[model samples]
Target: MPGARRLLWLIPLALVVTGGLAAGATFLGADRIESDLTARTRDALVAAELPSATVAFDGRDASIGNVPADQRGRARSVVLGVAGVRTAEVTGQPAEQAPEAGGHVKRDLQVRLDQLLAAEPITFQPDTAELTVQGTRSVSRVADMLTAAPANVTFEVGGHVARVPGGDPEGARTLSEERARVVANKLVEAGIAEDRVRAVGYGDTRPRSESGTTDLDRRVEITVR
Candidate 1:
């Protein structure tokens, strides 16, 4: 009878130990899974040769922020190949130029601004807006451009957006306009004359990209008039 009682005690003890082992195993498994996913996703981004290799993984949905100039798709495909990555979403602009024409100083400044926009690509985060590292570089170039331009020249910082397909045209326009405003503010902070610069949002009305299906359609254009 005493042995029987001891056996019952051992049964409970064994069950507790087994339960703890199971829990520990589950935790380790989960951790391994997450680590594997993160590693694979990061590797895919590197393989894609994406410019901005910043990745935001939300479960099955993975988003890349900084794509290099000419290899966005290649990078995206690598991510898609990962078993758990359901989608590889790109959330930034490409680093490209749309040609240019201006005198030495003006052309130089314009090129600088273009470089900034291409690298930083204005991102509106909160009540207070700030430029990314790339933005800072580009804005510095614009400031240089303004300094290089005629001291008394007046400039208009206009905003423009690509038209949305089957979406709210007015809303898109407003957003683009606001984006313009933000860019203007950055330019002003970089030392452009306040009176010389003005920001106007065009919102999806004047689109550089007509299709409106691509991220390029949603862009910020700066026209210094």
Candidate 2:
């Protein structure tokens, strides 16, 4: 009778061991299958046997376009032949406007202009807020960006000053503020709304760059709102 009772106990233990082994086998089989499929897909992509083409994806669908004038047919064949990829819908017109669509118009315009916020140090006429030629160009570009923005756009003019050899911090702050106001006035003259602009100055508070000491200390930036 004791042996029969021990046999009953062993039955449950055996069931538990068999269940664990089944679960482990299932997991390993799934992993191997997934790994094999991934390898095949990667190899197929590298082979370029499917239709190869430049296609544009618009969330739901991909549309292929003229394949560089010379490789259109081959591109279509290659891209389409890929194992899992859906056939691409081809189009005649441009898929989407590129950054270079307008002859790089925006970039050209920005290049001709100057960054209102710069690390380069700019000095005004001695003791006055008058901007030199380079400063004027920078200020003009800022004005243009502001005015060209939507009519309801607002901006803040931030001025920074370099640490002068003998100047006091307090005076520098005041001067920087004055310079900021001067820039604001120029923007107004260039057709920006005066009511939408405010000015603030940081005197020797923010350095231009981490490495340099004096190359880029004084500057200005226009924050768009």
Candidate 3:
């Protein structure tokens, strides 16, 4: 009788151990699946040249981030095409636009442009309208971004120069204008339509610094039109 009781107790203990092992195996398998999905999705985005986009997964659903408004559809499609992704949601995008929302879209593009230039300002050779190597690269990136923008959107390339003691205002204006033209031409060469861009020179009238002229004053700025 005592042996029968002992056997019953051992049977329940064995079952409990087996159940715990199964639960652990299931959890580990789930983790591995999520990891594989993340890597594959990232590789797919990079292959599509949307490396700036980020992704995260919850089960089979994916959340994609940092995708530009114009590229949202493409990013979502790319993610959804992944083998394990059941659904994809693009985050951080502007809402569906109404006809009256044109201004908002323009503003959003302007902010993006500003952030790009802030990180990588377009530079030129000393006192010449020629672009440096870095400046050329920056222009190329700008071109790519603008190429993705809406067709109705336009841009203004504004150039400004620093003020110096007894500097020739006329000369400054001419230099600034030439710089603007050079940048505009580079944009056109890179793929932007000429009709969509306008170049203007502000000369020393728009110094970025209130106290004195700095290197920043001799710079170029882009505005959405």
Candidate 4:
């Protein structure tokens, strides 16, 4: 009877050990994590009705590609709302200059900015908003252009960045915005009224350069707004 009692205790103990091993295997499994990430990402996209968008997971960061530029914000919102995602990247075609000018700096600068920066593009630090010596010189020319611009017209300085792999999207955004502001401040110092200038950044979303990481892409584009 004592042996029978000990056997019964051993049975429950073995079950507990087996259960722990199974649980540990599931928790420590790479396939399991990947499967979970994929499911969670896809479910969020589907729930948001974003069938066309797909997410790539790197650690906890999710890069969602094939999203339209206009829908980028919604895509990010959807993915960031998902648990276990650290950062979200919404990528697709680079944003284009507006079909016509007004409110959108992209549209206004497509042709006009080229005319201004035709000689040399403005250059910034690899991951910063700081202007290089050459960058400051480039903006001096832009100041001249703004000086000729009519006071009735307002100009917006749009900043851009190339999406570097593993780069921080938020950092890119901050750099771009600060770069625009830098150029805008320089133009103001050059005699443009503060009220007549608007500064904005589009980060890596609206790449003008072919490779997206050229001095050309990291430029301050001027648009009549």
* Cα lDDT, all candidates: 0.61, 0.60, 0.82, 0.76
If ranked by lDDT, best first, what sequence of candidates would result? 3, 4, 1, 2
Candidate 3, residue 131: Cα displacement in angstroms equals 1.9
For model 4 the local lDDT of residue 74 reads: 92
TM-score list, all predictions: 0.41, 0.44, 0.53, 0.48
Residues 72-189, model 1: lDDT tens digits = 7776777788898778876788644323434565556666666766665543432223344554465566666664465445566655555444767677666666766777776665
**What's the CA RMSD for each of the models?**
17.1, 16.8, 10.8, 16.9
Question: TM-score: which is higher, 3 or 4?
Answer: 3
Q: How many angstroms is residue 53 displaced in model 2 relative to the true structure, after the best TM-score fit?
A: 51
> Candidate 3: deviation at residue 93, Å?
27
Off by over 4 Å in 2: 1-127, 210-215
Tens digits of per-residue lDDT for model 4, 89-149: 8766743322432444444544676765766677787777888778888898777765655
- Candidate with top lDDT is 3
lDDT of candidate 3 at residue 67, scale 0 to 100: 77
**Residue-level lDDT tens digits of model 3 in 1-225:** 999999999999999999999999988998888889999998888777565678988878899998778889999999999998999998876443324328889999899999998887777776778777877787888888887776578899998887888888899899889988988987766556678899998878887778437656767889999
Best by TM-score: 3
Tell me the number of clashing residue pairs for each predicted model: 9, 11, 0, 3
Q: What TM-score does model 3 achieve against the real structure?
A: 0.53
Model 4 lowest lDDT segment of ten: 94-103
